[model samples]
Target: MTTKRCTMPFLRACAALAGVALIAGCASAPEGAAPKNSNGWVKDEVSDSYVFAYPLVLMDVSREAATGNAPGQAASNTLRNAQSLPPVGASSPPEPNLDTLVSTGWLDLGNEPVLISLPDTHGRYMDARALDMWTNVLWSTATPANERVNGLKAQTIAFVPAGWKGTLPARVKRIDVSTRYAWFIARIQTRGGADLNAVRRLQRGLRVAPLAAWDAHGKRAAQAEAQSGAGLSGDPVETGAPAARVAALDANGYFNRLALALEDNAPVPDDQHALKILGDIGVHPGDGAQLPSGSKDMAMVNAGLADGRTRVATPPSNLLAGNGWLWIGDDAGNYGPDYSLRAYAAWASPGLPTSRDEVRARVAQDSDGHALNGANRYVIHFSAKQLPPVRGFWSITAYTTDGALDGDAPVRIAFGDRNGARRNRDGSIDVHVSAERARGGSNWVPAPKGDFRLVLRMYAPKPQATDGSWQPAAVERQ
Candidate 1:
């Protein structure tokens, strides 16, 4: 017979009845005293609790980094638009998209609602989304649940606090957000370097402002010119990227940050039990300023930290894996009870859009399930009947195992419909992958001379692609 897993509600009830004294002892006991719980139990709880809090902590640190340290017009309620595509081989952001230019900003809803104004895309492909501090997608143009009439249409939106009643412009739609902080990201299609100017024009048309100023009609000269990045106050977070900085934080630093973040980004109902368990280890919200000082307790904390990092680095079971490929879909961007999957997604792609907007699949092995090496030539043959199905488009990009484009590659690092890859007479497409140019470079995707991987992205994918009714062909050694 299978054993049932211990549910959080049961754990909470047990803690209330018998574990309260033990928890108080754990919290107030001297560092050198024997641990209130067994070493293994403490280690497991610490790791699990850390994973539960990872997304919020990461999101908070990322906001500080982006709004304070990033260049351009990055600031609270102001956008930092990318003037060009990410440089080839840039490793700062893993798996950068080559199809669109990005614009990002943060919102502060503690005082008032923020207004976002968007211009029409005129049939061009564009997507925008807003995520709460817990990394839950509060609103997305591409998510069917949002009921956006036209994701690319000219529109205005007001992101208001959960209980705030406000008067917005007659045409502005109001979206209630539960957190005091939110993140907004927008992407506009760009064909290539030559097409950047057009995308920039659209980017310039986007605007963000405070709802009060907008209602007053003056708009404070557009919120004092939208609080130019130059006027940004406060010392930025440490110099490194947010993810790296978060990883480097110590036990006290990390847990304290989480405690402070919870003041604004309150936990959802499902997180109550997890929060209670965290208190047993003295990790209560607003009270994680100090960690246990005993050597034995510190060792358990450190081990738990290392274990949590490893668990998040490993792929979660929810990913759709097949034919040597792994991917995520509709389940991403809105995880409710799956904290492991949520942390994994946040670590993998901090600003990932909903699967309805895009689906990304990666493969590091060939048809034989061997690690892909650039020394061997390969081909991904898509039969005419099996071509990727998408409403927007699809592309396959080659990257080093470390997730960087090959700097030494002579030909393009990616190939797809946009490249107008040559097709066979049977209407099938054969995408050649090799270190050397293949078939005179027609539909050729260059690879590094060592280990490599491939990423397949389908934007606005059709139902078949996400439902597993359709799958990309395996990569065969040539």
Candidate 2:
């Protein structure tokens, strides 16, 4: 009989060969590959996946930052009130409006429904906007269709999670929220420093709490609890500020967080195609995603992230453009299934955006096609018949090129109907835009000492303003 020997080296070599073959088989591209120069199906899939997940990722990071454990920080079920307006040149929230005092809070609906109570505004302009995890406005008092009492009557609102069953007070309006977490922001109009006390009183009147807590302690006790900084529990997520958290995340971290968020906050039915695309790449709600291991797969995902970032920063063709001004269309806040548009809005402005009737127009250049700088004077002339059509009011405000309030501008940086602008003999209004104070007081909108832009706000705008029939006057250099 022949002696058969199995050497250690031969056994090791066989195992190594088998491993290589298995890896090669797993990495092989699918059949029917794309032609040359085309971003193959893998890259396309990666691109679509990033776009589909950007908003959710962004919101998750923001929620973690806002509710995480920290000193002087309110927990998920409490309110945090901003007693005064944001400082000039506050980059945290670009283009901070001087018109209102804002109070913000995060809601946790996992346990039970929450109650929101608003005091009578006495004809003052006040709004409470609640956003879901995806940044969609779940409910807003600013929307005419949803307004509770026209700023004249006290109101109570109960926010319940999907499939929640309970009997609510007949007087309390119920709003259904899809996600377990919700963000609330209340804005009360402030005339100036002199009117701050009144606004503070109004802010104090805004209350939020769990339905059971509110029912047990009552509205006054709930408000006192929120103010005392009590009853806030520790947050489970560990994260920093929203922007910092996003920057710290790698491809794996970002995708993992997105997967987890999707598990909690299910996507709308319209997003089935996107969900399928994600599944093909081993990413599914409630399942820990397994990313492809090949170098080419990593490269495609990184490239897709870059592409999505660019798309969000660039305005789409549907934006309203006229005389160097650009603004979103009538579909400002209520985005149904337009992922790109929704992602862009979340990236640019994180809070609940104003509705179509509240138009916000921006201008970056003068009529002569030059970048707007404080070195030169400019004028925006609106004929009597061409004035912005708005039932509420109109105003023009200036900000730095990066969207911060121009700190160099005077305290009264904005001017419009509230300023009681002076009109010329022909009934045309000439708005002076310059670093130096203009001759006329009411029609002057202060500009920064360097490059700046203008935002024209028209609240309760008419059809002409929204339908693109009425265009803002050109900014002509003097």
Candidate 3:
């Protein structure tokens, strides 16, 4: 007989009954301790907790918002395709790539394993990634090098919970996830909107279903999970808009969410240190923050939350910085225990591809160190040899400081080989950046009216790109 796992709600109720007195006693640095030392410890705890929970909260909020009954909202456990590029000034995500049609969905792994089937791409550039509740990439088609050999072949992936005992088909690959919830993002390359039909055809070939809903013939079983309402149920938690959900979280709310997420998504062995820190501050897994109300400790917790937000927004020292560009090296998407780097990257560039599949360089200033303003034109001159080397392609996209596209331009704003970028007589390419169309023609990426940032994305980048041997030319003010 299978034992039933304790649910998050039940665990939370038990924690609440344990009371604040019990929590305070468990704190390593309790109130009335050394004022200076206590403050420092509290601050560190807040930062660590915030970084640890950023991805979890972000995923939860996004999943909730997307699964709502609204017109544009996508139901959970189903894939939603973006047919075209995001409109100008859209807040969905910054630096929207014009190269691919995006497909996104969330997975519910509470009942049984979910099977993801992919069709052979036949040399087409495409990747599907599965990120756990904490934002760690559990599985991706872009990794392990050999997976990309001979282009993408039709494959079956079964994502099961950790320690699950089941008999998977011999052909289907098994991926064990420690979390009950997972997010899916698939990017299929396209030359432009004209190539969208081909991408959509490939998109239709992708399928996701519960293990019970899968048949021995590798097809979906009819009327299996449908009657049980197993895979299609929406999340019980009511969540607001993604940004709003994040903004509305207070110290208590944030820790409570973190605690709840931990109940189901057990941390890896590497996270023991972080978990210990959180527990000392009364934010144990499955239990809410138990700090006493109107206490000095409570006040300190609030201050730490604010500071943690700032740190996540600021770039850490390890980010590769040169020529006015900032980027994570080969460790872009798969951050192990580097919570600070992971949190910061997620804040700056959400849904980043793994470094093997793509590396992004972002700059807000020109070569001379002045902020890039659309009113002042600039040029990114790539000499014949300086062009980004990639097995797939590269593009330079512009975004506002807040990570939104320039509102003035209706057309997709980017310049690259796939677009109509022109080469100079000397085999160099000059990409013009400005609000006004450049006289250079065909190589112009329209910037916003004010200060903006530029992202240089090298898809399927060559080894040199990530090996510290190749870097793009500096952006020069005109």
In terms of lDDT, model 1 sits at 0.73
Q: After TM-score superposition, what is the CA distance of residue 94 in candidate 3 from its true location, in Å?
A: 2.8
Candidate 1 at residue 175, lDDT? 92
Residue-pair clashes per prediction, in order, are 0, 0, 0
Best by TM-score: 1
TM-score (C-alpha, index-matched) for candidate 2: 0.84
Tens-digit lDDT track of model 1 for 362-425 = 8999998899999999999999998888777788888888777777776444588877778899
Q: For model 3, give the 10-residue run with minimal summed lDDT.
A: 227-236
Alpha carbon lDDT of each predicted model: 0.73, 0.69, 0.72
Error of 2 at 94 (Å): 1.0
Model 2: how far residue 394 lies from native, Å: 2.7
- The Cα error of candidate 1 at residue 387, in Å, is 1.8
- Please write out the lDDT profile of model 3 over residues 60-160, one tens digit for every residue: 77776676457666556667676666666764555566667777777888888888888898878787788887677778886665455346899889989
Q: What TM-score does each of the candidates earn? A: 0.86, 0.84, 0.85
TM-score sort, best first: 1, 3, 2
Tens digits of lDDT, candidate 2, 1-478: 1112123355334334422321121235334534324445545555567766777888877777767467655677667666666665554555666666677778889978888888898877676778888778887775563343246368888889899998775578889988888888776666667787787777677777777766542353534345423322121121224745665567678778888999778877766767776776678887787776578777876776666566666665556678888775555666665666566667666673555336788889998789999988899999999898876678898888877777655564458876678888999999999889887555888888899989998766776675566788999999
**The best candidate in terms of lDDT:** 1
